[model samples]
Target: MEPRKLLSSLFYFSLLSLLSANQQVVDSAHHHHHHRHRHLFDFRPSKLFVFGDSYADTGNIGRSLAGSWKQPYGITFPGKPAGRFSDGRVLTDYLVEIGTALLLIAAKFVGIKSPIPYKFRRVGGKHLRNGMNFAYGGTGVFQSTSPLPNMTTQIGFFQQLIKEGVYNSLELQQSSVALLVLSGNDYSAYISKNGSSQGFPSFITQVVNQLVLNLKMIQELGLKKIAVTTLQPLGCLPFSTAASSFQQCNGTQNALVNLHNLLLQQAVAKLNNETTNDHSTFVILDLNTAFMTVFTNKGDHLGSTRFENPLKPCCVGISNGDVCGSVDESGTKKYTVCENPEAAFFWDTVHPTQAGWRSVYSALQANLQQL
Candidate 1:
């Protein structure tokens, strides 16, 4: 899949997992208020540091430079383009929405909202407590399609913030969760550079090695927990499945994704073993299984909702060459949107509809318990 498309898909999956977990907490709270309160108090973190690509980025991308900032992107939520690649709220926005709701309903609880993007933290104040987001859309562990900072550079920004005393050691040690999302932008770049299939395995190894190093560095910086997402099945994305009339996933592409996830799991295990601490500091969020479950079930996981054709997007360009939100020189719209986005699984050629994400979260309920 294309890097940008993969980023959006993974972003939705990540947020779906988060929202699913939060919903469970909310449900438990309703059933057993005191028990849920105690659980929240015990696990609440003081700050959350987000890194990776567009999947986790709240608003790090430049408005004018990114297509996300254009019309129809945020038509569902904010009712205007809000720098999100979807028709409405993307992953990070949903995180904030759920967190805010938690704060309102649970008075004693202190919910962790999506962090401010690193670019907008220059005028930092109380918002710093929520931590900072260092992700950029279209970026990867290595350079990708975007001119924005890569994973290494994003980490450098985090290091700079710590060095400048933006976050004290005591604060970091007390409570902090670092979310690292690397959703295959590196592979996309490699393919675009004419890399061969034979060289793909070695390339994946290199990516995972650097990722492991990055996680360790975050641990050394005093983060108690670091969650890294396993890459989702790339072949199952709309971009790849389009060739099959969106009916079946490309086996070759999915095989590559499995290899990447296997290596990542091994690396996380090693990192945990190397740590002197008694508890695990590094964890993997299983996106592959979650995605497969939802796709296989065709959104039937949710009792009340059943998408007719889960693979067919709700919005698309008028023809093959066009895309969702596309327009001609004369200012003519070239795309079509479903009357009800809730009935479709995908919002575009790349990203999922908000309802689609909700179902995905439902499918991921079991896996999210690991977090």
Candidate 2:
């Protein structure tokens, strides 16, 4: 089939699924009354340092080569692709809200109206004086599918900027927070490259080792507080569980994720013990717990976060052989979406919906209080 016709078919198929599902958004806030008072980070940070893959990538991906910069990806924000690998926002956008708000206030004081946020400016000059996003989709600690720079390379870019006097000692001293978002892209790459499943334990060890080194490198860069996300429920990702009809997450896969988190907990502890100022310097964002909270209390959320079948992804290939992004010779779309993206927890095969992230953020408030 022609690619155009294939896309057309997929589009129509998605439309039909949306009509039939008629899912509605689930707002869980009212029942819980879980609002909490503000903490230090609730105000603002001088800078926001980001690392990792598509989950946190803002605009580092090149326009011509990345699907993140293509149509249908950013349909929800800026009315066009703004370099995010999702329909709307990702981790960096949510985290940057705090600092960007501060930048806006500073602009107001300078008698400048509506100055561009630091994220929108180049990572040179005084712009780096505020903050800059360093994430690129399809990137990992090690090489992955895309040709973009990995996490280490991204940090290298930062180091180069510092060497060029883009940031001075005083500005680096003011830098308060750094956000690290790491998922299973490294593992995915290993699997895709025919790395054996039996070797996963060893591979995970290597990945964590690289991660620890990366964290140390960031601290050496003179940033103070660092918050790193634990791996989410990987087995529950739409792509992994699709084979089970999306009804059940793979227990074995989840067990591996548990091991990774356990190891990470120890690493964080060790890092704190070694550091001079140990006020929760390495904070772990427990995405595992947050994801489970939403999944278990689906109905508790306003409306029905309860999918008649939660494991199944709303948008997917017509057949098992294809995927959400697949298309045939015709100009028909192969993927389908739920009636409302807000109602669905998972967005595509791997990422979550904007609503899903909101839920995760709410769950993380307790840990965030210490920040």
Candidate 3:
């Protein structure tokens, strides 16, 4: 019953097919090629404005309370924690990284680095042209568990930067994309705050309503394109999957997620209808479906990704009392990392590994072209 012991038993999975994983990556590139030529003639954005919680946080959180600043968080990419909530790159990084390589691949994308965090805006002055990532760990559309800035406050920071003449409106309207990664921190806060399950439906409506307002604010701010991710399947996250020994998702929780995603789609459709002239005013990344695709196709590696333990986190606490980033008084780590992070899906309890995000992004490529 011990936590680490439970992991030791659960992780008796067969050795993952590294060749299959590599082939999956190659197939992902080929899918990108399917649309590569299409992007060549499109007006590719040079700047990316990111907002939301830890799912897209790129070092905006400080070292005091965030595990992102601790060891093993970013070991897969930068070789150390650079504040991304995962092992390495997140959805935000994949977007910028892939788009930056467009120039060479016939996609006509201009090279751009991950947007500088607002926390480093002063020292990272020149990089402001690449846009800003104002997202913080554990934040939500409304007030959430962590005391960091919520969506409103994050947007306020972006507005303040504009007021200081840190950005030009013309460039924003001409060649910038706003990525809003809202991955259900609101529901986490709701449950943690003892919100009644009976009122959950109404709360989901309220969350999506506020989210629509945020999208409008960003759109009215003159960004050329705005992309918002639908809520991923929260019920399939490791925390929810633990009850199934990482074999199946919690269907009860997933039903709620389906409701949330439906509402979000309706809201986005209305917004696009009202504001779209020649181009779409808003873009949906279909994250909910993408996540489902990965989960449902876990064992069928014929044409999809190969995640042997799709619901199991790669890193976990060695004991029930510890967490992925827990350390003892001696400053010794209390967690265990899998031998191959690239072969895992979920990184900790909630976020994905770099490979996990890569797979999810690969699955979402068709949806991404809308952006």
Candidate 4:
């Protein structure tokens, strides 16, 4: 075959795989309220149940106070903040792939509608019955960061839905994939509360322990596959690297982050081994490596994405008294925005642009297939 034809064929095959998977999800969701059913699914999940903090937050945070809600955040896609913490889509949006043929077929066979009507307009309400997200921004595995429910409490909400019969076990078994993201809000809170570096190791262990427990709980609640994230290079976040003028990542902080990721991998391994069904029940999405790849390939990656300076954020405060979302006492805007948000990777100080998330999503495409 010609090179162009070969590439087109590969793309079509991938599209077919996604459509078949989404169809199964629609079929399973249909029978949940009527009768229990089971079907083996080996396709990428169409529905994404996002958890964790800002990295995966999709408008769960309030607009008035969150930096994601301010100007220049969504300048790339929506032309304004549409509840994402970044200038465009976050990890959740890019991690998801919705093919039109699948949605149309689902609408025909299942008589279901898409929950996000504007985005997936043709699909009816029945399609949305596959999954619903419950993540909130600024939250941690523990109860210290955001006023919203922590990881435990978030699980509690899922439990409540189960009790109300919103999700039957069969539907959970067939169509569900949980995206659990714990990107270190707990550690940030610990440091802000005066926790010392000497205690960091122990705290890291505690966080991992809690995270493992959370993943187990999600599994116990009947989710088929749980995709937990290895924490990103925390020291590399623009917020932490700013002290060095965003030119270098803090090696010490990255070392600590590696320890946390090591523990998480171990926990995932144990979970996979312990599963009675002998399936690849637990998978760790390697966000750390993906972030590093993007950083190291900055020149090549940025040029491809049309980003001039990927590390620097598009919207930022001019001084210490301001932040991306802050306003002056006189009610004037205190932040500055780059001429083109899509040309930058970092959105504010810590978050990535939609383009950045797309890059990370591409890196994790293989891992996401398990779900």
Candidate 5:
């Protein structure tokens, strides 16, 4: 070979060797990073146990009884009603969404997912480890309009499952986090039953007292972390504001709700105090403040396209006597839906739309960090 050609060949060989060495170092560093990423966060909970009402219920209600199973409930999600009270996913779904998103930061932080409804656990298969949801629409800590299990009865079901060896104490102690949502169904039932305003304060006290007992019982069951939600702004619900054409909230009703929340906060604090060794096992998720934040500053919280009227619902009955999802004997539709469900805040008279829940969840970031 010519001298120049030989020199050129040597130069190219050295360059190729250097490039190969650099590639090997990059691969090794990437492997180290991926391995570290998997083990960096040790905060993931293995199971999520859900309790309370329509806000957290996945599909615990019977198709014939719960309006959630009727049309327009799950339209934004599974493309049809799937027994969720809202037009799509509810508060629990958004919780799972946040948890799932955490996986991008740390692979081992598998994050909490919405538990399977207790009624569907027989067919849950591999999903049983995700925990169980005992929530039923229209039910509360005490009895309400719905015939489904009350909070006490719901806990009974959990105890029954435990006795049946479905979940061992060690398993619960090691990996469970319970979420309790009591969103004012009891108050609704009280008013409907003609319980006078004079008795409202005492009734709220009873409700919170029972709720505190329920929270303590859950802790004694071996689950270490429990999150109980405060009542949302009741007067802001479409049902209360409908009298004002969704223009103004009923101050009297909201005052009652505030009283409930205040009592709840104190109860949670007392529970936490009793468990000093555990250090804040009972966390208060302030849905009340979060809802108000979104309602009061819809444009600021949602950005760009806000709810046209934050108090106005996206679905309603055609007449005064009807309700959302209502149909006549001839199967004629008796309700109307808005042009854009995503642009609305409330889904029906009581529940928030999917977008509404999403915005509320974003506002709850500061509080959820405690979880």
Candidate 6:
């Protein structure tokens, strides 16, 4: 492929992968476990039920389909690929690391490690203690991008788990938390379907409407504490910023994101108002604010980690017709990696480096207290 076509293809990959049913989210910026979570350092939940796209998927996507299952993706942390979208741990790993130490979900310091993915549920023995990860790559609140399973379908899987007696009603009510992450794949689908930008806001409303239904369903299904992430600034993703040489963001796209977030906030607020009497049920992980903080603050959390180019990716195709983990038939790597992935905010076109996620997590501690 030509240079321009390669860039165009990468851009397409960015949009499509942005909300794949599951992948990476918040990192410690440099995998800094020492960073204080003043609010959640002692707050521990019995189980965490994670849902939605690539942003929170620890390892749900199939090995054959996901680039995350390939090499150089998890090179920074475990020294090998283990189904993470970034170079290291993502939000889910941080949330479940052992005793405030997220060395990849050993259950953060007295907390449970990242739960076993649903695919491994049958074979995952002790690993199933914390909860289950049902996220799939390339999925959304409504069906889009991939046919694997939408959020509703993912919820149905959870519902089945509950029916199988994997989790009792007491755990769901007293100590379980559900993490829901929805990237912009639905909007990507809308654009791909030739939906006019003029109709985008209405579409945002429709999307949020469906999201609320999912949220309510989770509540009805029994989890008392649910954490849903606000959309990150879509314009700041590398694919969007690449057009500006990674020096600026597309305000028009961000404006649409703001609209979706506003409607979502309102809906969550209403749900809380009607549902909460003693303790709140819904918590918003403001990925938008946390992500913006990292973009502006650079390497605030890491001892020495810094993102010189916050909107640029650390791993990329070497040239035309390749992607982050692309490999040639001759068993040669097709992508180039940066000297240090921790210093780059993005790992690939659509996801954050572990360091980037850590920075975002540092900013999100206050909100996690609610969970």
Clashes of each: 0, 28, 0, 10, 0, 32
User: Which portions of model 2 show Cα errors greater than 4 Å?
Assistant: 1-44, 98-130, 144-146, 299-310, 320-330, 366-371
Give the per-residue lDDT digits (tens) of candidate 2, residues 1-371.
Answer: 33223222222211111111000000111112112111223323456667776677777666654555655566667667776655677656654553221221122212112212223556355555546677766666776554667789888877876787766545664544566667766766666567887997888778778878889988888765566667777777666676776767767667777766666666766676677653225555566766666776652244435444544554566776555455678857676656766666666666666656665555544323322
After superposition, candidate 5 runs with Cα above 4 Å error? 1-43, 100-109, 299-305, 367-371
lDDT of 4 by residue, 2-27 (tens): 32222122211111111111212222
| Candidate 6 weakest lDDT stretch, 10 residues | 21-30
Better of 4 and 5 by TM-score: 5
Local distance difference test, each candidate: 0.66, 0.56, 0.69, 0.59, 0.69, 0.69
> How many backbone clashes are present in model 5?
0
Tens digit of per-residue lDDT, candidate 1, span 59-162 = 78887555577767777766887666667765554444454222322233366776788888888898787888888877777755556788888988998888
lDDT of 5 at 62: 80
- 1-371 in candidate 5: lDDT tens per residue? 33222212211111111111111222232343333333324445678888887788888978876667888789998789998988889988887657622332223546666789999878746879889999887677785545678888998899888998888888897677787888766766666668898998999898889888889879888887677777777777787788999999777767777677667766665565566444225655656666777787873253743876999989999998677788899999899999998899898887888888887776665433422
TM-score of structure candidate 1: 0.83
Q: In model 4, what lDDT does residue 177 have?
A: 69
lDDT tens readout by residue for model 6, 86-162: 89988788767632222112223356668788888887556777889887766677765454678899999999878
CA RMSD, predictions in order: 6.4, 9.1, 7.8, 12.3, 20.5, 6.8
TM match of model 2 to true structure: 0.77
> Each prediction's TM-score against the native?
0.83, 0.77, 0.84, 0.78, 0.84, 0.84
**Per-residue error (Å), model 1, residue 234:** 0.9
Candidate 6 Cα deviation (angstroms), residue 43? 7.7
